[model samples]
Target: MIKGIKGVKDILPEETPRWRLIEETARRWAVLYGFHEIRVPIFEVTALFARSIGASTDIVEKEMYTFQDRDGTSITLRPEGTAGTVRAYIEHNRAADPLPQKYFYTGPMFRHERPQAGRLRQFHQFGVESFGVADPRADVEVIALLWRMLSDLKLPSMTLEINNLGYAADREAYRPQLVAFLKQREETLCGNCRRRIDANPLRVLDCKVPQCRAATEAAPRLADCLSEQARAHFGSVLGELEAIGIPYSLNHRLVRGLDYYCLTTFEVTSTSLGAQNAVGAGGRYDALVETLGGPVTPAVGFAVGVERMAMMLPLAASSSESASVYVAGFGDRGSAAGFSALEELRLAGIRAVTDFRSGSLKSHLRQADRLRSQFALIIGDDEVVKGSAILRDMETKVQQEVFLTSLSSQVSSLLRIS
Candidate 1:
């Protein structure tokens, strides 16, 4: 038998409730925070990522899934969400329309990486981006949205770590000192770290390799190189987070993988996720808009790994079947009437399911039990002849006969769908 690809997962029927729960939670909070939904193409010109994510980063250099098209154009499946959102913001001339536009998107992202728990070649992310906002308050707002999604999900042992990557100029000043430190310990660093030292020195500090991490432990902190303005911006973000009572700690080592990020950066890590503890992360990027050929627009955003979040979900969230009703239609005329009732219930805003193929009332009830339906709308010949259907509480096995015409309204009332 043929099997699924490595590092790629199929979210099966049994597993979708958890995903819906996570996605729905994100959508509800995004709406509460004034973030509109935006959908972008899954793939874009490969240069878009390389230029925005940085050529030196692992995502651009080693992990991107780039393929040549028929016309020989290099296209890549998006490895992250922010770049595409910014591309749309510029290409659609949104810069001229408004200031501080916010958007949220949930979908798949591709990267070439080894398959492992909480990591995948084709994983999903629920991300939000806020554009054209330079205020530190915008940073705080985006961080609040991020915290809301994870906090409401009730994941345990989650910690919010914030940092100041400072501005690019600040990093430039800190670079020589950081590069000097890494160079002194060059022998202990990984190959990736050595290459990153010259190209993106800050990344060497961000490296997860044991040797690279230990080697840079005593390196000069970027916080020291932060400009006065950068310091104020980060200070405001921290003070506001405190004002809002969102728990957080300062972690100078919390650098994002992308190169566009600057100033305030943050991550939410859960002990439940093991070594790959980061469930979501993002930061402010003040220079990316101009870098991508648009007017300089400062933005802040975050991306949550949907798979990792799903893994952290409690078992109670695994099933979403309770809110629906099953229509068990047996026999010819009863089945026909049942089909009509199914549509009526659905049109009235009820979630209804059916198995007309069930040959007997016993079989139909069996199927409804298997579905874990809260209520079963049973229509057999006798009930059809009476112009009524049986509403059986699958859990209680208590049955009631209601006229077919009132089935939708009755079910709607019973399910409290109004």
Candidate 2:
């Protein structure tokens, strides 16, 4: 037998309700925040991510799933949602609109990584992005929407970790100071951190290595180097969050691993998943669109993992209350009529089912009992000749005969729809 590729997952039937609940909640909240749904393809030209996500970052260097097509063009399954959303906005010339465009998406995202806890090679993300909005208020609004989404899911005690990565000029000013600090601790930093020190020093702060953490503790902070204007923007974002009663905490080392993040980076974490505790995170990418050959556009967004949300919810018991009527037949002729009766029940808005092949009456009845059907209809030649049918309550074991003409309405009333 063939097996699914490692690191990917199949969402089984038993866990569907929780998935549906999260999707529904996100949709309702997105619409509430004036965002429309945008659907994009699973694959795109490989340059889209390499340019937008930054070639130096891990997502571009090691995590992307890139393949060369027959046309000799490279394509990659999207590892994140923001780049595609921005690409759609630019390709369609959405900037022509008078106001900012808000788009939300929920779909599978691919990444090449070890599968552990809520992390998967082909996991799903529900994200919302706002393009053309440069106001600090927009950043806070996006964070508030994410907070509301987690609360709606009843996720327990989520903590919001916020940081400011500083703007381009601010980074240019502080890069040397940060580099000097990392160089002094070169002997103690992790191998990855040591390599990234020259290319992207900001990522060194995000390292999870114990030795690197202790060594980089005294490294320069982005907040300390924030330009006067950048400082005002960060302050305004926090002020708006406080004005709207959203709670958050300052994490000086909260630099996200991605390269595009610049200012207002934040993450919502849960304690349920242990080491893989971060459920969602995002921040401002003001220069990403311009970097991808479009006019400069400021954007902010976040994505929540569906699998992690499912893990945090309570386990549900399997309930068999859905079946209200079951039709059973003893012969081929009766089987055809039984199916017709089943359709009639369904058209009348009743929960109904029937066996396609004829079987013994006792065996069919047992099947109905197993389904917990409230009502069972036994169809045979005798009932057809009498122009009537027997309706038995599987629970009470009571039997009654009624004219076929009135059966549809009777079932509707019994199910309380009428």
Best by TM-score: 2
What TM-score would every model get versus the actual structure? 0.88, 0.94
The sequence of per-residue lDDT tens digits that candidate 1 reaches over residues 88-119 is 99999998886459999989999999888899
lDDT of candidate 2 at residue 242, scale 0 to 100: 94
Candidate 1 stretches with Cα past 4 Å from truth are 209-211, 322-354, 374-418
Identify the leading candidate in terms of lDDT: 1
Expressed as tens digits, the lDDT of each residue in 1-418 for candidate 2 is 9999999888777777777888999999989999999999889999999998888888899999999999999999999998898899899989888776899999999999988878899999999998888899999989999999899878997999999888988999999999999999899998988998998998888889999999988887878888988899999999999999999999988988777888899999998787889899999999998888788888899998888887898657223345788888656666667778888888987889866543878888988887778888987778877777788888788887866778888766665731
Window of ten residues with lowest summed lDDT in model 2: 314-323
Worst-scoring 10-residue span by lDDT in model 1 = 314-323
lDDT of each: 0.89, 0.86
**Alpha-carbon lDDT of model 1:** 0.89
Give model 1's TM-score versus the native structure: 0.88
Q: How many residue pairs clash in each candidate?
A: 0, 0
